[model samples]
Target chain A: MTAVAVNNIVKTYGKKKEVAALYDISFEVPQGELFGVIGPDGAGKTSLFRILTTLLLADSGSATVDGFDVVKDYKAIRKRVGYMPGKFSLYPDLSVEENLNFFATIFNTSIEENYELIKDIYIQIEPFKKRKAGKLSGGMKQKLALSCALIHRPSVLFLDEPTTGVDAVSRKEFWEMLKGLKQQGITILVSTPYMDEAGLCDRVALVQNGKILSINTPQGVVQEFPYPLWAIRSDKMLALQREAAKLSSVQDIYPFGEYHHVVLKKGSTAAQLEEFIQAHQVDNAEMKTATPDIEDCFIALMKPSIDTATDSLNENASK
Target chain B: MRTLKFLLQKEFRQIFRDPSILRIILVMPVIQLLILPWAADYEMKNIKLAVVDQDHSEYSRQLINKITSSGYFTLTSYSGSWEQSLEQVERDKADLILQIPLHFEQQLVKEDEAALFMAINAINGVKAGLGGAYLQRIIGEYNREVRMKWIQFPRFNPDTQIEVTSSNWFNPLMNYKYFMVPGILVILLTMVGTNLSAINIVREKEIGTIEQINVTPIKKYHFVLGKLIPFWILGLVVLTIGLTISRLFYGIIPAGSFITIYIFAAVYLLAVLGLGLLISTHSANQQQAMLLSFFLMMIFILLGGLYTSIDSMPEWAKWITRFNPVSYFIEVMRMVILKGSTLVDIKMHLLIMCGFAVGLNGWAVWSYRKRS
Candidate 1:
């Protein structure tokens, strides 16, 4: 079953003509699937989440969560869905237990009644249950917020950047909790700016500028990278990469921290690359192929279509 | 409804667990109830008085002694000149000064009606007005003394055939504490519903946790009702405590049904909490909600007949008070406590309060939006 169905969603904010937060976007998530929308800040990820959660009305499209229309059936849908926003959202003044109880009470359930679903996660912070949520460590706060969100065992959970600012250990634990939730057959739709986390999702959508650039499994999208990519290291990495870029055979050249991750023309021979490097006298230069990940595919797919279209067409044409 | 009950329990727990909030919610109102009435009385006493005795005569000396011996005035000093005496009053050193002219005794002996000047400070106009009347009563006594000793006149008292009667309502003790405690309960209940509830919701919006609530299967009404119910229950708890303090400290119990008061107050709390929710729904942050709710609170209390009697207010202000729920609560509380008024007897006030309770909540619910 399609757990979440968003069709041609558009969210335009403010009265001014230029403020279009979300352009036409559409996607679907199957039941029990962990779907992720990976994008940088201001990519309309939050706006899309708001629309799906029925917190906002879309300008010109329809969305349904668990087969309920986002707009019309908002009330019925609200009871079956859990949402954790991009920012920490709990009563900071209230203790962890108080916050948990307050949220549980709103859902007409007791923590003990639904303890099994939340026990593993809640127990981690139960020691600090008497401590104010505001004063807790970031990791503990995230856990408390998640436990509160899932206290009623909603069928589908919507997490908007749940791990935006926490230690790596907590972020890992949070995703693990999400995976544990998925095991219970809870459908999850999470959005984040972190690229590494994208690999953990069952399916991922690369979104930018209020548009989805690509939507596929992490490996599927990455395998579609149509280039011979090489991580080139040299004594003068910057100068070497710039000199390598002068060769017509080099398709794209960009620095990747200490070294440069360079792309070559499709189907170009390794012999074509060796001759060019020797001509440039790029001292102590080493070029070897590397596998493409979601970030690589994301950056490749996010390029203006006109720029990448010719190369994609040429790569397919030669095939 | 079950959710509401649970929310209410959570709210009570949170408020009780925080000692500082407990102090503000419970102890502070009791202190105000105990101390404020005594501090705010309109009755004037312990006045500082000076006499400018220009005439060095027995009658003037006797008059000065009489005025000094009066407990109302504490003959602070003797002024050498009229200007200095007037200056003393302007400086607020004396509440009043008696200016005795050079021929003051001669005029009193010869003239049937002699003018004795009593200059009173009138900053607090009502107290000043009453003080002048009190001084007149003392002067009348002095006149009777003078007439009886000098002329040997038969006293024909006007009160021989007339009947004077009066009775105090609600609080026969006339202890201002009795009146104030109920008023403080109203204030405390309003603070919980207005300040605390408003901040609570706005705090969620500020931190973005409202999104979590928004995405939950909990209905929007559930969300709004859940938040409001807890504060409403807290308001009731504070109300009960405040009422208990009033009864404990001053033995002032409401003559009306306590259950009826609680019921109406509970219904009225929906309106108060609704007001706070309306503020929270519109505000972007807790600070704005806190400030806006407090500002509205100040205006409501000022016009609520808490400090001033609505009946004594100007017609325009009286009309304004008609729309103020606080005014109705004050009137109903005073009526029930003082006159043993039944709900049926105070049906008009109850109707107005019910209407307000519905109207404010409607406004609150309608004003609440899904997003800021």
Candidate 2:
């Protein structure tokens, strides 16, 4: 059975009319699978996680966690699922031990019963157990939150933007902890805006503007980039970007650290691109055929959807 | 039941972990209860009086002495002109002016009557009114004495005398502290109960911890109860401290048994804490919750008859006090402590408070949405 399933979920906020925060969002996580939702801020990732965890209700859709309906069997689902919100939300004044004990007791379980599940993460922060959560570092706080979320031995865990603001080392260690949890057969659905983290997930759904742009394995998403891409570099990257945009054969130009990923117009070859760069008086320009990564795919998928939304908005204003 | 216990444990830990909240809950009430009663005293005394005696006759002088000796008035100015005396009132140095006409003694002997005028600074209306009444009583006594000496009436006569002797019950000396201490105790309890719980829940929302609790399996009633019980316990502690202060400093012992006061207080705390939770559930942040709670508490304390009598309030205000839970508790506290009222004696108040407890808390729990 699928550990979690969502069908045709739609959510809108505001009172008088509405603003769509999520539109027809649907996905399924197979039992013991790790799924990631990749999106920027305000991409409705938190709203989706809230709906799936039964903390909010979708306007017109259905979801089930561990075979329990999101609306009807909310009690059972709440017991079986763990939710760590986008914000670090444990009681700030409470000591680490107190926070862990509180969450465990609320779930009708004791720390002794679920000690093994959180032992790996908890051991690292054990020396700071007596300190208040507000006094802990960002990484320690995240670990403590994860420990509290998992103290009940939940079947599924939902983490929203868990590593949005942490040191690079902590973010890497946190992912390792998650991988360990996934190995124990717990379904984990995590969301992050970091494109590099997408490679770690078994599968990923790229979301933007409350819409799913694409869903596939990280490698699969990269493999499906429709256009032949090139990385172009010069001494003056900004000036190079401006001059390259003026090229008639250039389809698109996006700055990716130390280079720009340029898609050529149809029937435009690399020899023509080099000739255009030379003709534009660009010095020592280097160009190479490049493989499209998830970042390239994300920008490629996001641009047109934004254009269509803006087009509709303009269309509405004209009326 | 077990869920409630665990939730309450979490709540208590959070409440005690903060030193500031501990001071507010445990120490602030003791200081307020100790100090507030002294400021809230309503007895009017030491009223400054200015006598404008133009006649300078025996009757006028006698009246001036009687007024000055009444212990309620202090002679601030004794002038011959109304303008001089009015200046004293203008400077706020005198609260009342006793103006005697030029022919005051001559009129009493020839016309068999005399008229005296009083001008009072009514800005502090309560003080002015009480001072005027006290002066009037002293003048009445002087009139009777003069009448007895002037008209030599026989001790035995055909006329029958009907005298009215009044006695005070509950508070023989009419000590304002006796009335104010219990009422202030009620206000203290309401403040600690409402403001604390209101801020408590909204702090969770502001800090984003409420979302973590919302995703748990805890029932809404259990959450509300968990939030309420800790503050409810704190409120009772405040009440006990207030009562102890009243007893130790002011020598106030409840005329009724302690059980009656606690029984009423427990129910009152439920209603008040329920109100706090209601405000918190509706507010999105701590500032809104604090402002909303302040607005409601101002209305509650004013209409609760802490400083004024409900009977003297306008009809509409009295109607509002009927719905005010603080008013009921204040009245119950006064009745139980001052008047020695038992449970049976205050059954109506107890029932109304219980109704408020059930109705307000039921609405609060219903309005608290776990899935919002």
Candidate 3:
């Protein structure tokens, strides 16, 4: 069975005329799969997690986790789901072990019962278990918070922005621990604003402006890009981009990093691209074909989907 | 029932885990128990006086001695004349100025009335009223001597020997400490325990722990009630200790039933702790909770009738005081300790306190969020 099944979920704040926070959101996660909702701030990732965890009610939709309806079986759902909110919410005055013990006790369980699940994460900061949770380092706090969430041996784990402010090393270590949890067959839904973390998920839902743009494996999303792309670079990059945009051969010109990656119009050659740069009085220019990664896919996906739908129709009809 | 036990245990652990909460709980109560009553009082003390004895006769000297010997007065100076005595009181150098007038012993030889004039500061009506009472008592004692001399003839003085008598009940002295200590103890306990539980959740909300709890499977009521239970018990502990210290050390025993006093105290703690939880649920951060609590506590203590009797309040205000849970507890506690009142007598008070507890707790639990 799917670990989580959310169909047509909706939650809105403010008056009816105000912005709808989550508009008809839907998704499903197979048991044990590591899922990620990758988006910027206000993208409704946290809102969806809230609804799924039963902390919030959808205005007009249905959602369930591990066969328990979020609305009707809220208490049962709370028992089965582990949620690490975007902020460090554990008791600050309690020692690390006390915070852990407190959460464990709340669920009517103990640390001994589910020691193995959180053992790896808990052991790292076990030496400082007597120190106040408030006084712990950010990374240690994250570790302690995670252990608190997992203490009940939940079937589904929801970590909202788990790697937001920690150091790169800790963020890397945290994800490694998450992978181990997934290996234990626990479904995980993690959210992050960092696009780079998208690649680490088994599947990612790219969201923007409170709406899901695409949901697929990271590599699969990248593979959906249709056109061959070229990175066009020159010392006079601004002039090159303007000239490239005006060129009949160039279909799109957008800067990816240090260089503008251009798509050729239908069948334009690299020779034509070089000739155009020269015609534009560009100097010290370089051009190379580049593979589309998650970043490239994100940019392509962000573009208004109207043109892509036409292209998709042509591709489908051709097939 | 089991859920409540679990919640109660959780509240205690949370309170114990936070040293600040414990300090506020344990230390604040003791401080208030010890310090507040000392600053609070009703009796007037240290009235300044200027005495003018124009009749340097032995009769005038003895009368002056009677007034100065009283502990209530600090004789500022002996005025040279009645004019100077009036100047002394009007200039604020004296709270009261006394003049023993001289008829050159003529009034006494004829066995007529010897007059004493006293001028008093009445700017503060209460202080002035007390001053007037003290002056009257001292002059009355002097007049008793005057009246006794004429009594040898056994003539009619109609007012002479009216047989003065006074009976003071329970706390005849009514030491302010006895009244204040109990009220302060209740205030401190409520301030500490309720914040410990309620603020923990709000703090979590602020730092994001509440969001984490929201996504968890913990029942909302269990989580909330669990938090409230520990603080409630801690409040009980503080109250017990406060009662022990005051009763054992200060000899301020309650005249009412011991069981009734404690039961009322427990019921009242619920109202206070519930109030704290209610404030926490509505607040967004620890700071907001702390500030709002401090403000609410101030209003509860001041308006709670700890400083003055609520009965003296205007009719509308006296009615408003009925809603103050602290006032009910104070009234009940004083009645039980000072008057030795029965449970049947204070049943109405207990019922009102129960209403406060149940009402505030319901409001607190309702304001609390089960979801994001």
Give the top-scoring candidate (DockQ). 2
True contacts kept of 2: 0.85
- Best candidate according to TM-score: 2
Per-residue lDDT of model 3, residues A263-318, tens digit only:
76545577788787666554878888988787776666566633663356235322
Per-residue CA lDDT of candidate 1, range A1-319, in tens?
A: 9999989988888876377878888888999999999999999999998888788889898999999998898887878888887778887778898888888877778899999999999999998888999999988988988898898889889888888998898899889989999999999999999999999999998888897777778887777787788777778777787778877777777777666777777777667667765665647777777787777776666665336543563354224
lDDT of 1 by residue, B125-221 (tens): 7767776777777777787677667775457753455555788755676766667667767876777778887887777777876776666555567
Instruction: Give the best candidate by lDDT.
Output: 2
Fnat, one value per model = 0.76, 0.85, 0.73
lDDT of 3 at B109: 53
Per residue, candidate 3 scores C-alpha lDDT tens digits across B166-215 of 76676787676777776766666666656665676677677776676666
Tens digits of per-residue lDDT for model 2 on B108-176? 888889999999999998998888899889999999888878776777854787989988899998888
Each model's C-alpha lDDT? Answer: 0.79, 0.89, 0.79
Tell me how far the alpha carbon of residue B238 in candidate 3 is from the true structure, in angstroms, after superposition. Answer: 1.6
Give me candidate 1's TM-score against the actual structure.
Answer: 0.82
Candidate 3: residue B99 Cα off by (Å): 9.8
